[model samples]
Structures are given as C-alpha cells and as structure tokens.
Target chain A: MAEKVIAGRTIQVNDEGYMTNPSEWTREIAAEMAKEEGITLTDKHYAVLEYIREKALAGETLTIRKIGSSGIVDLKEFYQLFPGGPLKLASKLAGIPKPTSCV
Target chain B: MATKEEYPLKKVLIICAKGNLEDVYAALVMANGAVMEGIETKLFFTFFGLDAITKKRMNCLHTATVGNPALRMPGGLPFPTLLGILPGVEAGVSAMMRKEMDKLDIPPVKEFLEMITAGGGEIYACKLAADMFKLKKEDFTEEVLDIITVGQFYEMAGGIGTQIIFV
Candidate 1:
C-alpha cells in the first residue's frame, strides 16, 4: 500500500492508484486524482462519478454499459470521457475499488 | 489453488467453447473484468463459440437448456432438464434471460465486443473451427484480430503470469 497526500489529507492507495478507504475521500481528492490520471473534472464527469459513488456505497457493482444507460451519457461519450478503461478508471477516480462484475 | 499474489496475472486468455448465450456472455464478462483490472485480455472463440464472433449468427444465439444444471425457475425452483426438449423452450428461456439482462443495461454481443476492445482487449477465433465451418475472415466481425491454431493459442498463453480460462 502507498500513501498519497491530496488536499493535505493522507490516504492509502493500492498499487493501481485506487483508494483503499472510501471514507477518506473528498471531492478535492477526486479532483487531484483525476488530474493525475490526465482528466479534468467536468459537470458530466461529476454526474457519472456521483452516480457510481452512490451505487458503490449501496454495495452495487458498477459497469460501463450500465453507466451508459444511466441517461447521463451514451456509450461513445463514456469511452471518450474515460478513455482506456472507462468503468475501472471512473471507479478509481470516484475513490472506490474496482468493481468485480462485468458491465 | 494458487494464491492471488503468487499469480499477479499479467494477462487473461478466455476460451469461449460454447456458443450458447450464457456461455458466450460468461466469457465476455470475465474478459471485461480482467481488462478493467488493468490486465491484458484476449478472447478465443472455438466450436460453437464462433457464434459469438460470426457477424451473421452472433446475435441469434440461444440458451443452453438441456443438461444445464444451473437452470432454475424464477422462484428458485429447479427447472427440469427434460422440459428442455421442448422445441421453443430454449429460445423462450434465452429471450427471458436477455430481457432481464437488458433491464440491467447489459450491452448486446456486438457492443460488448466493442467495449472490451475499447478497453484494450483482443478477440481471436480458432483456426480449425473456422476452417471446418468454411468461414472466411470476412464472415467475422471486424473486431476479430485473427483466426489462430490451438498451438498459437498456447503460445499466446505462454508468457509469465498469463492465465488461460476456459468457459
């Protein structure tokens, strides 16, 4: 485990840069991590992020196509927004662990 | 069984040997999960698995009702295997399953392939299976990178930390 300091708060992250503790997350930390991942947080990004965060907190697995059908963005926009691995990257940016299920 | 840390998998090779909707989706789901976890992933289609990558037949896959021990009714009732012999039963079951998955917003077979590739996953069809079916390269969707032999499949699975999963 590695520790990263975002917004002057130290938090543990896995080797893949996902937060180990969800309770330690803040919007500022998300912004910082998104920057590190070469993404700028937009309103659209926030929409997806918030949705994932909520679903994750409720103990639901999130998936790329599920998010695409969320009425927030389509699949093409999701791929465009998150690039390499949309659901994985988005969940990491949302300060959550990678979902174990498929989309 | 190997411990997780003992096999810090670098890649996952999923072998889709059955073309049944459930079987193909199982392979797809696992490969998609691997790519999401930052592991390199590839799907190999063989036997009936060709139905998943073939452009004409991919979307028309049916559920495997006969001999499916896991099949059950909605209320946890075990579905009798003998009933699977009914002509329309398999298709009906498949349609119901697809409807449930659609409600969860699961992508269809084609879009599922696209999503996996977009996440840096690769798709391959087995050479012998293709040749037996007389399938030209053009018969498959563009997402298929190549039709390869089982030896080549072994080679693809040869690297350290590579795991071959049969589904």
Candidate 2:
C-alpha cells in the first residue's frame, strides 16, 4: 500500500516494498531494485528474474524446485544469484510479490 | 525514546528420528524451508530417521499404514487396520502420496536433501544411532557431511538466535 519511485516511475508496492503491479516492471527498475539489496544485475541474474516474472505473473506457483528446472539456472546458481532468500529476493526484483511456496 | 528491537532466527538445528514417509517429509520440508529463507540450517538424522539418509532407503520410504490412526480411505472412509496388513496396500498408499506431492512440485527425499544442501544447509548423522544400526558413512548418500555425536551437534548449535527442533 505504498508507491515507490524506481527508475523515475512511481509504482505501487506492498508494505514490504514489493511491486503490486507486475506490468509496471522494467529492466531498469529491476536493476535498481536489485541494487538496493546490494546485488549487481548480470545476464544470469536477469535470466532467472525474467523467467519467474513471466510464470508467476501468469498465475503459476513458483518454487525453487520448479525454478531449478526452468533451464535458465540450476538450484545452486539461483541461491548464488539472490544470496539471502533467493526466491523472495528474485520475486522482489522481478517486480512481483514475495513468493509464497515453501519448497 | 523506546526503540523496536527485532530478533530474527539466525540458525536452526532440526533433528529427525522417524523413518515413516510422513514423518521424514515433515522434517525435510521444515529443513528445506529454513534453507530457502537463508537461515543457517543443520539437519541431524538419528534412529529410524537414518533410513532417510541411507542411500538404499531414501527413495523407498513407506507410510506406516498400521498403527497410524490418521490414515484414511480415498473418500474419507475410516481405514480399517486389517487392510493395512494386506500386501501392497501400504506401498500403493505411499505411491499415491508421492504422486500427490510430485504434482505440487515436491521432490523425492533424495532430491529434497540436495536442494537443501545446495542452499548451504548442512546434513549430519548421529554417531550413536549409526553404531547401533551398524551403519557406516558409506551407507549414507553423498549429501551427509559426517556422523557426529550429540555433543558435536550441540557445539555447532550454539549461538544467539539459534533454535533446535526435534521431529
């Protein structure tokens, strides 16, 4: 229930700063969001984020197990990309809400 | 002025002591969840739980059809214990459970352990139980880091914001 100005655009967000509207996401915005977490976006990082945004916004349940098999990156790489809380951080940078699945 | 202080869980020690399908899964799910949260996770398998880490038995775990009051028929009918003793019935039920979990993207026990470790979770076997069962390190999957005693387990469990859970 807040608005964040990222990459020069005011976007709706939740209390935790997760974007409320996935459609408002842009590559620039994602980079900025990741920078806040002290992560620099690389091709490999964007690959995982883009994949999840496409599937999760389309009403798919996202989990590490599913993402591991997405062919974009493996499970170990996913953790390395997002460091702390891979699924949660990936979802946030993807401009989607925090992931809900446990696995 | 008063300030808000947040004390988040920094580490978790989970102990699994059962080999039944549901029991082992409960431990796996909790351990995996902790790892996903970026928590420092440690899992110790002892007693019957050792079967879960045993290379030969990890993927072939079974649901205890008998002596389990919670088990039920497909349509909510109270399951009769007599049917549990029937050959293949328990196996069939366990298979169905696996199928259901698979549909939800839950991996088998072996793969689950891999996922946890891939996220930096540590797995260990209890030395006392390992001796009682006459099992050795080679009998466990590559996922296990070592076989250690309770004292060693506690040594690592020490720290602020750390919690130990027994299942």
Fraction of true inter-chain Cα contacts (below 8 Å) kept per model? 0.42, 0.88
Docking class of 1: acceptable
Summarize candidate 2's per-residue lDDT along A41-89 as a digit string, tens digits.
9999988888998899789999899998899998999999899799999
On the 0 to 100 scale, the lDDT of residue B111 in model 2 is 96
Instruction: Give the lDDT of residue B133 in candidate 1.
Output: 89
Candidate 1 Cα deviation (angstroms), residue B52: 1.2
Which pairs of residues collide in model 1?
A: none
Which 10-residue window of candidate 2 chain B scores lowest in summed lDDT? B64-73
TM-score of 1: 0.77
- In terms of DockQ, the best-performing candidate is 2
Residue-by-residue lDDT tens digits, candidate 2, B89-134: 9999999999999999999999999999999999999999999999
lDDT of 1: 0.87
Candidates 1 onward: DockQ, in order: 0.42, 0.90
lDDT of 1 by residue, A1-103 (tens): 9998887899999998899899898888888988988999898998988989998999877777777668998766777788767888888988899776656
Docking class of 2: high
Off by over 4 Å in 1: A1-5, A9-27, A35-61, A69-86, A96-100, B1-7
